[model samples]
Target: MHSKTYILISFHTAELGNPDIVFLISIVLAFTFIMFLTCEILLQGSLRDHSEPNDEYVIPHGDWFEIVSSPHYLAEIVIYAGLVVASGGTDLTIWLLFGFVVSNLVLAAAETHRWYLQKFESYPKKRLAIIPFAY
Candidate 1:
């Protein structure tokens, strides 16, 4: 039901624009969708089924986790930025979109880094928490 609602919303919102705008939006949306799905599939076994309480906890089976921490939140930023870009070049929207992406990336990176440090004291010193290489 939730996924259905998301699809419907995307469809309706995608339609509320000029044909050219819609076409561009469709491309951005497609990119966001494909990237998200690909990431999910690639990290399937590693994803947790339930969200833990808002507290520090040891993540079991480090090998099995889709995101080191909060990839969904990052994806949300990507999705929204794509939408704003697709909606045409709105200065305010672009600024907000970029801000959202940067903020989420920063927060997710920090949280994931801390989790890695605590969850695996011996985690490969070279392995980054979120963005690969020099996060």
Candidate 2:
């Protein structure tokens, strides 16, 4: 592999100690996370005008929604995953928050996915409920 040179921004603090490789990796991962969030938001915004005030909005369709029932929830998980990495993945607080978030979103997506199937007979079978293939 061809390695590129980089700069380090370190602060030796008594409480938190010094920044290291994981922190830097997390910073890069943050960019990926924000992109996911931005896409999810913009996509949902495009669909919002077409799907409100009617009961039809319960079942999201088109784009990422076409593939998974709740893409925004997926995005939220990804954003939190980025944070988990940013925190070096050992923070119990972040892990618990991530767990709760995943659980809640999964439940909601399951309900929404069921609704989509019930509401639209033509809802894609290949598409998942949430969390891609696992869900």
The best candidate in terms of TM-score: 2
Best by lDDT: 2
| Candidate 2 segments exceeding 4 Å error | 1-8, 12-24, 39-46, 49-59
| TM-score (all chains, Cα) for each model | 0.53, 0.70
Give the worst 10-residue stretch by lDDT in candidate 1: 58-67
Across 1-135, the per-residue lDDT of candidate 1 in tens digits comes to: 999977875775666645566667778989988767755753554445346644555442343133344444455567767767765656786778678777867787688768777777765555455543435
Query: What does candidate 2's lDDT look like per residue over 1-135, in tens digits?
Result: 122223233332222454566456557587757768766675766567563376545445566776787787788777777777667667999999999999998999899888878888887887888877778
Q: Report lDDT per candidate.
A: 0.61, 0.71
Structure candidate 1, residue pairs in collision: 46-64, 46-65, 46-66, 47-66
